[model samples]
Target: MTKITYVTTHGERIDTEAENGATVMETAIMNAVPGIVAECGGACTCATCHVYIDDAWRETVGGPSSMEEDMLDFAFDVKDSSRLSCQIKVRDALDGLVVHVPSRQG
Candidate 1:
């Protein structure tokens, strides 16, 4: 399982284990991490699962795809590090991934 950490807007840290091929959003929902609303259920239609990729993990996580970027337009407080958790797939390389949840969803 890949280990993922979610730092909430309130400064709460939630750690979770995710299977390979699972999306970060899926893991967040499964682990009951607050702040990842996932309103569209990973469909890339909504940005409720928006998160900020930690600087250390940016290259590994990569930038959002064009489609994802377009969808992210609806997210709150969009930033250069902003991403939709549903677009981030878990893998061995992402074993220590860390993400930050926004204060609110779009």
Candidate 2:
């Protein structure tokens, strides 16, 4: 399992464990982590699961793909570190990943 941390807009922090192969959004939804509505599930067709990766984990988490980038256009408060949580698969290498949720979804 991988450990993922979610920092909310209100400065609340939530830590959860994700099964290897699950997506970041899935981990959030399963753990009832707020700020990730996942309206379209993990399809990456929507930006409801958008998150900003912590600077320290940016390179490891990497950037959004073309499709994910297109979808991010519909998200709120997108930044250089913005990413679609649903597009990020959980893996051992992703343990300790930290992401920040926006104040609101699009």
Identify the candidate with maximal TM-score: 1
Q: What's the CA error at residue 106 for candidate 1, in Å?
A: 0.8
Model 1's lDDT to the true fold?
0.95
Question: TM-score for each prediction?
Answer: 0.98, 0.97
lDDT of each: 0.95, 0.93
lDDT per residue (tens digit) for residues 1-106 in model 2: 7999999989988999999999999999999888899999888888899899999999998889999999999999899999999999999999999999998887
Q: Residue 82 of candidate 2: its Cα lDDT?
A: 95
Please write out the lDDT profile of model 1 over residues 6-39, one tens digit for every residue. 9998898898999999999999999999998998
In Å, residue 43's CA in model 2 sits off its true spot by: 0.9
- Superposed Cα deviation of residue 55, candidate 2 (Å): 0.4
State in Å the error of residue 23, model 2: 0.3
